[model samples]
Target: MDIRIGIKDSAREIAFDSAQSPKEVEEAVVAALDSGHLTLDDAKGRRYIVPSAGIAYVEIGSESTRKIGFVA
Candidate 1:
């Protein structure tokens, strides 16, 4: 799975194998959810909070972007 992480006011791409054990990923996701720094309604609702970064936001797969063959 490809995921984006926010680091020091910037976003970076991360890759995780979908076939790996789900435990670590699940734990990370849960921790992120509990952090409360990620608001589901920020930047028109495309951002989430990560422990290492203040905010993790994505602008991928939008209608216009998709039409132009861009994948985020």
Candidate 2:
């Protein structure tokens, strides 16, 4: 899954790939909001923690399904 995190007052967004399911991600986001900090792990095992107050938006992409050729 691809996740993009937008920070307040920043033009560049933080993007990473993870293996977490949609439900898991949603739970994490909620937990972060309550705890005041967001923590996430990438596919490569790198951990990212950001202050919840600095987060502008979170865009999560669902797991990609393989497709062949062009649309007809």
What C-alpha lDDT do the candidate models reach, one value each? 0.40, 0.92
lDDT of 2 by residue, 1-72 (tens): 999999999999999999788788888998999899999999999999999999999998989977899988
- The lDDT leader among the candidates is 2
51 in model 2: Cα distance from truth in Å? 0.5
Q: Can you tell me which runs of candidate 1 are displaced by over 4 Å?
A: 16-24, 33-72
State the weakest 10-residue window (summed lDDT) of model 1: 57-66
lDDT of 1 by residue, 10-44 (tens): 54643222322335444555566667543222333
Give model 2's TM-score versus the native structure: 0.88
Candidate 1 lDDT? 0.40
lDDT at position 20, candidate 1:
21
In candidate 1, the residue pairs with backbone N, CA or C atoms under 3 Å apart (3 or more residues apart, or in different chains) clash, namely none
